[model samples]
Target: MESPASNSPRMRLDHLRKEGSGETHSRVFELEPCDHDNWSNPRFGSMNALEILRETVRILRYNSSGFMAIAALLICPVSAVLLSNVLVDLSLVKRLTIRLLLVSKSSGLPLRPFIKQSCQKFAEMAISSATCFPLFITLSLLSKAAIVYTVDCSYSRKKFDTSKFYGIICKIWWRLVSTYLWVCMVIVGCITFFFLVLAAVCNSFAIIGFSPNLVVYAAMTVGLVFSVVFANAIIICNIAIVISVLEDVSGPEALLRSGALIKGQTHVGLLMYLGSTIGMAFVEGLFEHRVTTLSYGDGSSRVWEGPLLVIMYSFIVLIDSMMSAVFYYSCRYSTMESSDGEECQSILESVVVSPQAMDVQ
Candidate 1:
């Protein structure tokens, strides 16, 4: 039996039933590849970073897979952020209320109910923070897994199957965890080293009686450089995660693969990363500013702002993931094409044929 599409590469699966010490009967099923053209997507292989980013947005807007990813984002990170913001706002309110009560103590306004409510709010915020920490970690993993699954569907033009996708993620979750650990270690080490260097430099300046302004300027410069480097590092590691999921490779192998895959596309990746990071920061800042500045009459407007910000930021998270996935595909397709297509064909063969030994039932 042949698979669905005739034009794409096909997988031949052989099923055998043993018969008394010999395997005489066998069944063959040809599995055709999906209709999606990975190489032909406008985002794939485009040298213009804007073109690539625009294509990424287009996919997230038009593709059903993107919605699945968005759903996962809403459940996890978005909720976590919203809860955190609420706690922060509540803390501010608590401080302000305490100050007001102290200043008006002699005015004889009823204070028992207000004090009780303030204490209750504090307790609630504390519990929410404690609850949100674990929830954040768990949901982060799920959201990331969903992003990888969505990227695969985007490439293959396959329908999203939550069970199957997450099952694959479960099988490979350890690899993701391992890569994430290493990535975190690298980031922390670099940041520590940078700070150490900055301290040494500042100490030297201090010893020489350098102006305070100059010392502060030096610190700012170092911080700016560190931010840029950190963002780039994150972009590289994210691509490695995508490769690990798609290629079913080990953590170290995925790192090596990503390094090679992104060899010529580093600048493009950096641009997209910077744009996404800056955009996120700007939007979040605006949301927080509004929460602080606007008068919400009965406090309901403030209540609604929290959820609105969550939804907006959740969509941003989804788009950012989609952009990274698009960038990964673009780099992979471009690398394969530049290498004369043999690499691409071999990759497909490895994906399909390697499953037979372990997957046959």
Candidate 2:
């Protein structure tokens, strides 16, 4: 009983629906290429540890000039001071060592040779760190910020804009500083916890009349556990620094976000940390032997060897920072993929519901 004019409108609606269905299928086909491209892109796709390292190297190569400048200006100074121990006060180290020994003796703990050695090393490290704390907050942190920003620009297919980077750093400097302070506190807390636990274990063994050898073995086991925990903590803090610079979060929130981001990627982080630690240690050993302890040709070898080792040490540090930045992206990309799957499903459901609603209308 409908008029022919009304029938025409219905026919037109049916034709449009048919066209819409075809277009939807074509859109889906188009998305396949996009998905493939995204999956192939290193920045968009999830990467393994080795892949991340490769990408970091690529980024470094791409922005070598910028990174080198940052390393020379900031990182090299820190490395030189640390390697030469120029800023460390030997008197302060001795006093601190004595204080630590006295405290341990007063606490009724046995002052074994191992304990004395540990105290001496700890005191020296503490003094050096205190002396270099200023450099750490200023130049070292600035270098990290610069490296992170440069890596981000490289990933985005842009050049490093110094003026823009400076502006960005100025705004985020406080945040970076706050995050670093928190990181230091966390590290100190971990060391304190390690010592307390070690002390307790030793005390328990003493009470049980355990052999000294057994106590030493137990201490070694504890040291192994502490090493793993400490490595994990360092990885988390490094990622937190990246997060603080690249995102809006800082301090504890950045740390929490980093922990969440790295949940399934701890092994990768551990491997990266291991590689960097080894590289730095090797450089330090070379510096200690060639420049500080051993003398060759009236110590002229140190003239070149010391600077060469410092450069190597700085380069290692640069790579480590870059790796941390790349790791952040790798973790972030993986996280996005999981979230994107859920989003795509919801979108598909909505698309399906839309046609049904149109039919009802």
For every model shown, what is its TM-score relative to the native structure? 0.69, 0.80
Give the clashing residue pairs of candidate 2, or none.
Answer: none
Backbone N/Cα/C clashes per model: 0, 0
Q: Candidate 1, which segments miss by more than 4 Å at Cα?
A: 1-44, 65-69, 72-79, 82-137, 292-295, 345-361
Model 1, residue pairs in steric clash: none
Candidate models: Cα lDDT each: 0.58, 0.75
Estimate, for each residue in 1-361, the C-alpha lDDT of model 1 and write its tens digit.
2222322331222345686856564433222244334333322243446756665554554466556555654454655465345434556556655664553232222345644464455454544544454544366545765675655554444545655554565566687777765665666677668757666766666567777666656656876888777776788778876766666675667777787888878888888887777876766666657665664677677677866666666666666776777677667666756665433332322333344412531
lDDT for each residue of candidate 2 in 1-361, tens digit (9 for 90 to 100):
2121211100000112355365531100010112212432323444566766776787788788999899999999999999999998899999999998886664345679987998898898899898999999999999998888777666544566765565576567889999999999999999999989987887777678887777777777988999999999999999999888877778999899999999999999999999999999999889988898999768899888899999999999999999998888667756756666321111111212343433433
RMSD of each: 14.9, 14.4
Candidate 2 segments whose C-alpha is farther than 4 A from its true place = 1-44, 101-116, 341-361
How far residue 88's Cα lies from its native spot in candidate 2, in Å, is 0.4
Among these predictions, the greatest lDDT belongs to 2
Worst 10 residues of 1 by lDDT: 4-13
TM-score for model 1?
Answer: 0.69
Model 2 vs truth, CA RMSD: 14.4
